[model samples]
Target: MPGNADTLTTIAALKSVSKRYGSVTAVDRLTLEIRRGEILALLGPNGAGKTTSVNLLLGLAGPTDGKAELFGRAPRDVAARRRIGAMLQGAQLGGHARVHEMLALYSGYYLDPLPRMETLRIAGLEGLENRPVVKLSGGQKQRLLFALAICGNPELLFLDEPSAGLDVESRRGLWAAIRRLKEQGRSIVLTTHYLEEADALADRIVVIHCGRVIAQGTPAEIKNTVAQRHIRCVTGLSAVQVKMLPGVTAVNSDGERLDIVATRPEHVLFEMLRLDPALQDLEVTGAKLEEAFLALTDDNREAQAA
Candidate 1:
């Protein structure tokens, strides 16, 4: 439902926007919108035009065709961007500068900057306030970037791969911070390859492939698109035999184990048990975002090739 006219007044909008680099079309006829207080994750495989789309929204690059607007104004409009914060994938901080000093410098650009200690505390960097940015670990650097992002208390945020280099704990901390931002009723646009991140945080997800938006929906909707449930069982059956069962799409065997992909999991379970009454283990799960993404993008690539 992104880019719908009804949601135009919410946050960001791209109207049939396209961007090109010589012969390569980085973005193609894209139209999407970010809703206020919602986390929208833009996902794609490499070269899917994710970065270009973000740049278009930020007005770092103009669209080759339609328009991209932030709060109904162009992305380059300084006044419109005043209420926005951004953290690019490889954003740099003053390496030798102390954390508090760096925050203070960036805060000067905003109308009402968050208190230095408050920003540091929110980002979980309180103990590292006086430490030089240069000595921070990868996760620490990411937290510093987050601190910089919220220092302005912007209403809209753009985070590009916010958890790329973060360790597990650090990533969880960052996720928590993002949720807090959402609770504050701020809109967020996040881009990351981590499907779990999208599943966990995104209110809706838009999937792009080869510069085009291929799918858009909530995580549950997207997963349901596959219409297949994963059923695992401990049984004595050959993979090919299991695949022949009604409703079964795929079957894999690992010794005495069976993994079945089926359209109707309940029916599949009944049939599996009928096939082998001694079936011991059965686990039914919906299709995951990762599986849907792979299947969708691969199909897109194949279609493009054809």
Candidate 2:
């Protein structure tokens, strides 16, 4: 496919890729592409072949069928690999090296690397240059890993669970950093378990289930896949009573509070008000990303109409 203003150039792609280990198939004919400057969030449940797909894309493992390309070349190509950076899970970053020393050491690997000072600044680790890696907190160490990943001045980055162990503040701070990288025209493949993180940062979300793409779209588009709405309120209505409302799918009650899931929220709310005029704390909202995710992967839910 040709690149246009609206459809950006593809820097990396997995075309009908399938990875099999023994008789078990990890990725089943997965077709994915990474645009030049967009953040593509890869989401899936455990054992969903997310790791295997990433491994194929990064050339850590080869596909049993189809192809994995990096910069239009085989993913393992030396020149192509030079343009990529990755901060994968279970990486061992230890010993007594200081933050600055670590950055300097990683910078030497690439032919063209960002200066150690610049890498530190971009990673929000300027003043902590002298701190030992072992002494850093969970969040600080994560930032250090990010710095190492970017010091190579790579065009593409694979960040797997970048904020896994972070507190709320630290996670948001990392979010800002990721946004900054995107603004710099870096393509990032983010594999994260945090749905909200993907909702907040992804230019597009690709949800995988059973080694295949179950859904892929912009956040709004992905949310629209499910027709359900959420209604929560403190009312005098019982679960049995709310369940009787039109379009209501599920109802949960705790004392005077109730949570309702429905396909037609407007219809349900109208009936709710008529039945319980004293209802307070009433809030009706569209489906959350989490809700859509659950509904999309739900085995009990009928097979996707598409």
Candidate 3:
């Protein structure tokens, strides 16, 4: 299959890939590609096939149909696998091993791994190198996994919720390290539930739901697809009355505040104020990536139901 014109090189690709287990279809005819020097975020809710897709790409699970490739070669090929590094969810190292020892062990797998000190620094484990894996905190352990993934100095990296157990500070630190990796021209495939992480780091995002991709685009592009404005204010207007207004799709009330989702905020606001002249603290904001995600996924569910 040909690569996308926007990308300079195709590092990995899934061509009409599908994976199934008996009656369950984990991934359904999913076609995706990872480009060189780009961070592509795969996002979806639980049971949405995100992990299945990643497994297919990494050759941990074979596709029931179609193909998965790395560097234009089969993902299972040793050479192809060597070019890729992964930090899968729930992955763990030997509990008795020291952090540095584990990193050294993983480094030996590749012909040219990153320097041990560099990997330790990037993973925020410089001083903790002597600490045993079991002694590390959840956040520290996550950082070590991240360090191990890059230890091989791979051209492509796969991080499945790398910051899952990290605190705010640790998450930011990991983000910085990822940014540095990107600067060094490593392509990355990131599966994360954090929409903000995708918005902040991904060059492109693929949203899958019910084993199929519902949307794929840059963050702004995906958000623009919904084109809804959020209006919130303290108003006496009832949720039912607000929902009946022109261009209003949904409305929710929390105590004294009314939240309105509208395709045309100006029209909705006009109606809202007419009904409740005492409305105060009016705020209108464009649709966030989270809102767009919900709208797109909900639309797909509705379509499938129909």
Candidate 4:
């Protein structure tokens, strides 16, 4: 479980923050807090205002109403800004510069920057220091961006889809680096479309839809919101019979193997065992993060339509 938001030290916060572009509202009076030493994942589909929320916190855009703060001061304050680092999506450095040169330049911006070799190693770019930015692969470039973000030694880090275009191996490597940063007591705010990334990395997830937060909690808590479970077993029971069982929502069968989806697993399992005492290899699992995400977003759409 994540620490209570009320009791944790808030490194950044949005208080009734609303960002509007004339008639369109990008963020609709949304409030969120990023606490120390936790990875808070901001999840939403395209146009859900995840980017807008991050921009508000980074002071790239002013809110139409309410406030954004960092270290209890206005986000744009120089002293407050120094404590934060960000790797925003679609941002890039000069493609012609060598990796080490770019890092050295960024380091010069901070009074006490991380050593060049240390930044390179942390980003998994140790051997590629002399390579030009344009020559690096997609994953390497992304790692470079990450290195630049942490070079300032900021306490709070914001990563927006940090692994958007990486291959599976690259993505896993990035996850390792993020975990290392977390172990070092640096707080991170991650925004990603990858439900698996959020589920695997975040201490808590904040789901947004149509510019407003629709759900927020630990991974298990969020998954539990949908109230569904999956049960698998090798049994003689037919799919038709399983569907007829109490609390069973859906059922499928592959020869002797039965797959059941239900709102009440215990009730369904009891009824199944009562009918098939020989059932074996029973496996029960809760709703996946992907299912919960789709369900929550779909529910929000229906509510808006109503």
Clash tally, candidates in order: 1, 0, 0, 0
What local distance difference test score does each model get? 0.84, 0.85, 0.87, 0.87
* Best-fitting candidate, scored by TM-score: 3
> Which residue pairs of candidate 2 clash?
none
List, residue by residue over 1-306, the lDDT tens digit for candidate 2. 124362478889999999989999999999999998899999877778887888898999999999999999998898998899988776767879998888888888899998888888888898999999999887788889999999999999999878878899888888998888888778899887667888899999898887888889997776556568889999888899989888887898877678898878888898989988998998888876566567778832356543
Per-residue lDDT, model 4, residue 108, is 79
Residue-level lDDT for 37 in candidate 1: 73
After TM-score superposition, what is the CA distance of residue 51 in candidate 1 from its true location, in Å?
A: 2.0
| lDDT string, candidate 3, 169-254, tens digits | 98899899998898887889998876788878998989888889888899777556556898999998788988888888789888
How far in Å is the alpha carbon of 157 misplaced in model 2? Answer: 1.2
Global local distance difference test of model 1: 0.84
lDDT of 4 by residue, 58-169 (tens): 9998999999999999889988877888898987655788998999988877778888888888889999989999998877888999999998887899998899888999
TM-score per prediction, in order, is 0.85, 0.85, 0.88, 0.83
Which segments of model 4 are wrong by more than 4 Å? 1-7, 226-260, 272-289, 299-306
For candidate 1, lDDT tens digit of each residue in 146-237?
Answer: 88888988889899889888888888988998998887777899997767888899999998887898889998876665467888888876
